[model samples]
Target: MITLIAGGTGSVKIARGLSKTVDDLIVIPNIADNIWLHGLYICPDIDTITYGLAGVLDKGRGWGVKDDTFVFMEQMKKLGQDHWFTIGDKDLALHLVRTNFLNEGKSLSWVTEWIRKKLSVSTTIMPASDDHIETRVETQSGDMHIQEYWVKNGAELDISNIMYKGIESAKVNAKAVEFIKNSELIIIAPGNPISSIGPIISLPAIRKELESKKDNVVAISPLIGNKAVSGPASKYMQIMGIESSPFGIASYYRDIASNLVISEFDNEYENRIRMLGIHIYKTNIVMEQSQDEIILSNYILNIVNKA
Candidate 1:
């Protein structure tokens, strides 16, 4: 099976393309961006990938269901409720179902599988962990949930540290570890390494598994030049004391990934990344369109196939 570690919009784009071609694919999404809002469970990353795969995603907004109305959100606002995290009517329905299932004592992994199947999504999407682990951004003002930092505060604060609350007590999802250990190829999708992908690898079980299978692992750099294609990945990288460049990404994944994919725009860092003993593959990594995503997916698959 081809296993993908996915989170964030960039990762979801590639996951959508891979889903169309790879029948035996498994996607492990980060649950760190999950939150409880309006008495409902909200899984930002998981829902984005689920909607994208189900072909009902609002591509323009990069999240939520396409053509979904915000009447519920408007009504909530009229009631003086905090609706900073915009939830469309259709989007809220899924959250409601998920929350209900959780209250029924269902594990998150089980609920996620049920949701994917109910949406007619054939590709298997699993959370990194069933435990409640949250990503918190530490700033000068104070520590805030990742959603609050990004959506409520517009990600404007300078991050001093990032903490994965509940990770110390969290256990890696067993099936995720099994997939990573036995999969023929492992792709670390291009996402925010700090917040999107950090929480998954922060678990000792998952990290150790990847380290053991480093040869089969390939990481797609989120950085193009010194900036990320989307999100605040560059800022987080800098806060982590790593340069916001492809070279920096290579250094960060050096231990767990044997290969690194970078954009042609950042070819200057190819030699630098290679110096760290990582095999470099340069391409037009930006996927602004579905066709772009398909082409990149095929290219990466070919690279692994040849290996």
Candidate 2:
């Protein structure tokens, strides 16, 4: 099985494309984006991956259910609710079920797998941890949850610190550890390195386990031509005083990831990136179209298979 550590829509796009070409795919989703909003447990990354792999993702937005309506969010606003993070009616269904299950003492991992099966997704999707590990961003204004910084404030805050609240106590999901230990290859899908993927690796045991198999890990850079395709990754990187380029991405993953995949358009930086002692693969990393995603997925699989 090919185990993928993924978060955000970019990674979901990769999962969607890879599913068409590979079998026995297992996804470890980031739960830092999850929040308790409107008395519902909202898991953005997990839902994105599950919906994308299930062929029900909103292609235009790269997240949420296809053609989902936001009548529920509108109604919540009429009731004077803070509905800054819009959750569509259909999308809220999953949250309702998840909240109910959690209230009933079901684990996040169990709820996630239940949702995946309900979505009819073939891929085995798992959460990074079952604990309440929230990603808190300390901005110039003050500290706030990741969603508040990312969605409500439009990610315009000057980040002073990024911390995973409760991560120190969060244990790696048992199934996730098992999958990583047994998978033939491990892939870090393109997404925000700090906010999206950082929380997953922050779990000490998970990081240690992954570090033990660094030789089998390959990371795909989220940036293309020195800019992120979507989201506030570029801005976030800049705020952290890190270069928002392919080189910066390679540097961040230098220790855990043995190889990096960058866009063919970024081939000029291969030499500089390789100086970090990480192997580089330059190809079409942008997923603007399904065919593009498929080609890139197949290429990565071929590289791992040949190894």
- Give the best candidate by lDDT: 1
Highest-scoring model, TM-score = 1
Model 1, CA-based lDDT: 0.91
Tell me how far the alpha carbon of residue 204 in candidate 2 is from the true structure, in angstroms, after superposition: 1.3
Stretch of 10 with least lDDT, candidate 1: 264-273
Instruction: State candidate 1's TM-score.
Output: 0.98
Give lDDT tens digits, candidate 2, residues 1-307: 8999999787988888788888899999889988988888898998899989888889888788898999998898999989899888899888999999999999999998898888888899988799988889998899999999989998777788888899988877888988998988889999788889989988877787788988899999999867997777777787677789999998888878888898889977888888998889888887888898789889999888788
Candidate 1: tens digits of C-alpha lDDT, residues 58-157: 9999999999999999999999999899999999999999999999999999999999999999999988789999999888889999999999999888
Lowest summed-lDDT stretch of 10 residues in model 2?
A: 230-239
Q: Which residue pairs come into collision in candidate 1?
A: none
